[model samples]
Target: MTVLRGRGVSLSAATEGGERAVSIDVEAYYRRYGPQVLRRCRFLLRDEEKAVDAMHDVFVQLLRYQGALKDAAPSSLLHRIATTVCLNRLRGAKRRPEDREDELVLQIASADDTESRTAARGLLDRLFGRVPASSQDIAVLHLVDGMTLEETAREVGLSVSGVRKRLRALTAVLQELELEAA
Candidate 1:
């Protein structure tokens, strides 16, 4: 008999010679990767509590897919999973009441005039709209999250040189937008 266990589910199957137990210890995996996963979620979500929740959600997903992902790279796989989970959350999200107040306060404090802030925001929106989602994700991981190029590349499944090239292209787009505005 072969006994398999994962995520509180267990099964026993017939084997030719002897009994074997294959168990996936999800707690161990969570302990190993929880912090890293949380960081990835925070980078994507920009909220600490939401990041923690997303990290837990990623672990739950790992439980569901652990069998198939046995041979996968843990960090990259978890990062990708966290990214997908965060993106999904963002997709159907509505602005929270407290967040609106916080945004208003931040905008008032940071901007000398409302017009420039609005212009800058519009420019940023246009720039982001022009970029591919993957490149945006890479930029956020490296730039916003302060991840190293190689680390971002690993998480994004890209070569370091490819990430660098995309960053350069992003910079060019910014420059073009600035010149057009001027």
Candidate 2:
């Protein structure tokens, strides 16, 4: 008997004329790679809920290209697919209302510090309102969310170097604002 694999690879009877073929356990593959895929997606997406969506999208794409995944390097392949999914979602998304709500929540949450927190909140609100929307998102992702430059790049579809340049520009603006206030 002969069998055709999903990737179009074939296997025939193991005889003098046939070579033995190795089989992959798909369940094991999923178990082994699932956490890593989620982590990568989370790093790229920033938001926990959106990251879960991205992870699901990555798995769906992987299932669609099962044969290719079998042949390709899983980590790199998954990373590329996950990054693409995250970028697409980000590009399609508008400025979320939850972001503003979250910022307010953070401000309220920080009120435990009273006076200094009030000053910081005022400063941040003024500064953030002055920046472009995309720049503000990048800044919040990096500074408040504690994402690395590479992670911010993946989320915002910028190169790490480009993110660095933008961060520097933002920092300079913040310094000037601070000096003026002083």
How many backbone overlaps does candidate 1 show? 0
Q: After aligning candidate 1 to the native by TM-score, how far in Å is the CA of 143 from where it should be?
A: 36
Number of the predicted model whose TM-score against the real structure is largest? 1
Error of 1 at 30 (Å): 0.6
**True-vs-predicted CA distance for residue 9, candidate 2, Å:** 14
Tens digits of per-residue lDDT, candidate 1, 38-106, equal 988999899998899999999999889766555335678788899999998887354211122234334
Q: State how far residue 94 of model 2 sits from its true place (Å).
A: 4.4
lDDT of 2 by residue, 52-75 (tens): 878888877866766444544667
Please, what's the RMSD in Å of model 1?
13.0
- RMSD in Å for all candidates: 13.0, 11.4
The parts of candidate 2 lying over 4 Å away from their true place are 1-26, 68-70, 94-182
Worst 10 residues of 1 by lDDT: 95-104
Candidate 1: global Cα-lDDT? 0.72
Clashes of each: 0, 0
